[model samples]
Target: MSGRKYVTTVGVEVHVELATRTKMFCSCLNAPQGVAPNLATCPVCLGLPGSLPVINREAVRLGIVAALALNCAVNPRIWFERKNYVYPDLVKGYQISQIAMPLGERGWLAIIGDDGAEKKVAINRVHLEEDTARLAHSGDNSLIDVNRSGAPLMEIVTDAVLRSGREAEEYVRKLRAILVYNGVSRCRIQRGEMRVEANVSIAPEGAKELGVRSEIKNQAGFNHMRSAVEYEVRRQAGALDAGGTLRQETRGWDDVNQRTFVQRSKEDAHDYRYFPEPDLPPLNIDPAWVAAVEAALPTGYEDYVAGLLGQGLTAADVDALSRNDALGFLRLAASAMGDKTVLFAKRLIKDVFALANSTGVPLDESRLGPSAFRDAALLLENGKIAAEGFRTLLDVLYREGGEAERRAGENQLFVETDAGAVAEAISKVFAENPRLIEDFKNGKIAVRNALLGRTMKAVGKRADPRVVSGLLDQALQHQGRADHDRDTRLPRGKS
Candidate 1:
């Protein structure tokens, strides 16, 4: 343990349930959550005798989209295989999946590495498969709900390229954004629509081979995955340092304890006894279909982000928009708001999204729809409302759907537009702060910001900013010129 260095590595497997209307190989409804147990099941999903499976075209198209998103090469011809395993949740002793020839292969996703440089995470494959049933355990019995069975699931496996928990988290986060942004999946990790498995290992620096690895299964979220990987690395490295040989195994994360515990010996590909699925025929994707999928694809995530950044959005703003799932709403509101897109984005992220996070409400659940957002944004953009007034208007729109202008008028939130009142307010500020005016005359011109603030305060923050600014500038210019004239007329000490 004397200054010895170890390198930790992780390879992650993520499974996302597709958003198709039907199951992967049957016509059963794809909705599993909130449905009665086994209601969405069918003969094929239930694995009844003589029930043949038919591949869903929508699911396949979604897979192609997903593959393209990950920068994968789409395989021209693909077939399914039977992965045999004995599990209570797997009603079919042999689950249908793609192994020998998957929909896509050799994909890579770019992520910021531990060194803070852009690095690519090599992807082994992206394939489509069927999900198993849901299992709920009680005191001594287990309940199996087949509602989730046969749902189309896409699996993305990354090579052992990640060096730390942070990199893994970023990879998953970016991947989720790409899929969700493309309308490929909702990727609600809490609801099990997207799941993660991470393989973690550590070895002394310059070791010939990677030490034995442990597979941590079914982390609930990206943070949980990161935590699990970190813990596994520490545990494995400690064991190796103690001169103990590591063993390959499957493990589970104990969230309450913040640790990983062994589940069982890990299974290899041979252990699954995979073979060509005899019931389903192979699919050949023709050029026309491939072209159609390519056309359907949206702007790449990186490209869209670059465009947003070029439009004056900070990288941090874009990241926040993605995290809050506000990107789609931004797109809609921006298209309607025209040149004011950047301003709207700032208000949405800073004010609205923050409010949502604080109130335990999702952005989608708020009463503020895209149209309502455009209305509120217009009020702010056209200077009918102050920033404070805009926030208030949004608050009302979020809780009670009303016109932005009506809400602003009722709340007395609009800025005062009367020229007489604005002039009067500026005169009052000028009279009250004689010292500031003297300083401004003495070439302390930056004091104008203080003068402007005083003028805005004098109007109860209801004055149009442009009106205050223009009036203040004219008054200051007059004062500066008079000061110069007086100085010239009387030589300082003589006067």
Candidate 2:
């Protein structure tokens, strides 16, 4: 028999490639590129003898900004230690990272749940370190690219506050937004700009101690991270049901088959043989320096979302816009288009997000800029364009710009629903369909559908079909001879 319930404990570690112009210790470019491999390395990064390392000031500032944004308390003094692990891509044979003190600690992230509930996830620490290069293994031969060696990296570790797959995904997403907003990282998971690792385990309800945790490393995207955690939850539950022991190990996700395979046993701290690096000096972050970094930081995600809600936006719409780049566009649209700001804001959010997802293009790159969307919203609100015509207008503006609105007008796509004209048209249909009208009077009520068809034909698809059908039914019942009288609102047309 399986356990009554499951408590999934989740923790995440993310590596963000700092937006810096040079490597951590050298002047070489600190960017991933299509240029031939190993061409971007220099003597300092290659760990040649008699070469000293210099700290990159810009990388430290970016890391500080990220820490403050996450609400971490900055450490007064920071230092680096050597994580000794020999590998082909790691030319230095020892990574320079923080051991004794990280830049910040004790921060928290806020997440809104599916039912509009709030959850606060805590941060353990935020530290700065250097990244190793890439390794490509081709069957019998092994290749190494040192281009990324010594690239400045920031490691943000979260406490095990996540309870489920969804919460974990939300945490990562919010973190990505903050990093992008602060201009610290590009926040691209596909391009290896940001990397994620999740630690997952299952326990009995209200258990204080955790189960044996398995670390899933190098998940490529946010979705994959969520999937890995969910899979682990199920797999471990099955094992416990069958009387199997949980092993402490590392696993890799095979995204193609949607299964995780064991990579190796979990490592202990002694395995890395960590020690202070002899080459690099201790980082001393003065009081005034941290204050400056905090001053330039951007607004957090919660504040921005609150501002949007205050602008007459529905909570659901605000939630939708929070995940995408549309927040800025929505803000701009609301400011430019005044009346019915809420309605216009909702439309822009829906269209931009829908188009961006379907076309696989970023919202910022789509032809409809904020100003263009603002124009479309104004036309929609003022009844200058019909619902159907607005769709066509969007297509035209996306493809071609010259005289697009004029062309839409000429095409008659934006037809207004005239209530009087619709009532008149329905009356004419009732006059022509005599048999259906007689059937209705004689209590054969289904014949009312025939009158509806006639009215649809009379309108020629120019008016709203819903309004036309409603009016037609009402005109049929006003005869008063029929048992069930039709609605007068439909016959009188929209007020």
Candidate 3:
């Protein structure tokens, strides 16, 4: 037993179905959305005898691209091997997957830690495999749906780098974003398009050897994984404290009960007896084809941020922009207007993003388009329009942009800034509020604020409060000086 407190390590295996048109081994619609159950099934997918299978080119391309996006080293020469298993979901006796030579090896995903620092979680391998059909379990028996059988699945395994529950969640989120952005998979947790299983283990702080590993199976979401790991850590720590031995096992997360229950004893690698299939010929991936796929790979959000950094975006701004998709639109608007990037980012955070978030709409769907934004930003930049007018224009655009040619067309709604009109309102306010004015002359500072409020109510919020307050203060100060002068020089006969 070690003297130190505790340390936990986690590795995650994610199974994400590629969003390809056809299945991995047979040419059935890989996606079953909006289609009747079992309608997309084929003989090969149903495991009918004497049925030969052909690989989907698109699935292969996506597998390679996913590997690339994860920063994996792509293997040009790879082969598919059948993983033999007997399961209800497997219409076939075995699943065809890449075993010895996977498409990707040794990749990494960067995660942001709670301490506001970046950490990289290494991916041990990413392989191409076939997904079996799903079984719908009801009260009594189950129904089989072959529509999803033979769908292309990408299995990503991670090295044991995550040291905490939060890190594990961050790693999954980062990986999901990369997968979705690259168009390799939808990676929707709600739909079970992407699934995560965790291998959790703990060792005392100074222990040289790791404790027994328990596999937490079928973790539904990031939060579930976090909770399960936390519970496991506590359970192991308590057992160790009491001098009990930790056993290797498979546990199920009972989300409803919020506890982990023993599903069964964990299986070692040799338990299922994995063997290669002899039916399919060795998959010879040409170098030229892989290069073409790599060239067409989508640039991930991380890469986009790096590109922005090269263009001189600050670290904080980059973090903010990446968190908000509106940052992309702001970038587009800036590019179109040919403005400085930093200036655009400042305006994005200053006005555009704030308004969009307040309205609960996407930036693109907001009334502020590239042209409108550019015009508004230009007005603000040159001080041609007051901030009050700018905000008003945003409201106007939202209400009546359909009828107006430009935002300036709605300028009729803005309050007039004429000095004569403001002066008249100020004079009227002073004449009506005699007591407040007397209090102001008596050097009571609070009375000046009351006079400013009366003047504001007489006009409207559309009027610039700052300018009105300034004019009122000047008037009050002049009156005060004149009254003081008259009092000081008053003749004795008048008293």
For TM-score, the strongest prediction is 1
The lDDT values for all models are 0.86, 0.78, 0.76
The 10-residue segment of model 3 with minimum total lDDT is 486-495
lDDT of 1 by residue, 330-427 (tens): 77777633457788788888899877977777776688877788888888788988776788788888887777778888889888888788788878
384-430: candidate 2 lDDT, tens digit per residue:
66455566666666555435456567666554478798888777876
Q: Candidate 2, which ten residues in sequence have the lowest lDDT sum?
A: 486-495
lDDT by residue for model 3 over 1-495, one digit each (tens)? Answer: 345498798889999999888888887888766899989988988889999888788888888888888889888677787777678998888888877889899988889865679887899999988888889999999999888889999999999878878899889877876776566776767667898888889998888987898889878889999999888888888888888998899998988878788888887866656666566776777888878887865446676666667777689886666455444455455653233666777767767667767777645455566566666666655545556666767656544443223554457434457767778899999999898887666556777778888897777545666678778878877887787688863212211
Distance from true position, residue 489, model 3, in Å?
40
Candidate 1 TM-score over all chains jointly: 0.75
Output the number of the lDDT-best candidate: 1
Candidate 3: residue 222 Cα off by (Å): 0.9
Worst 10 residues of 1 by lDDT: 486-495
Could you tell which candidate, 1 or 2, scores higher by lDDT? 1
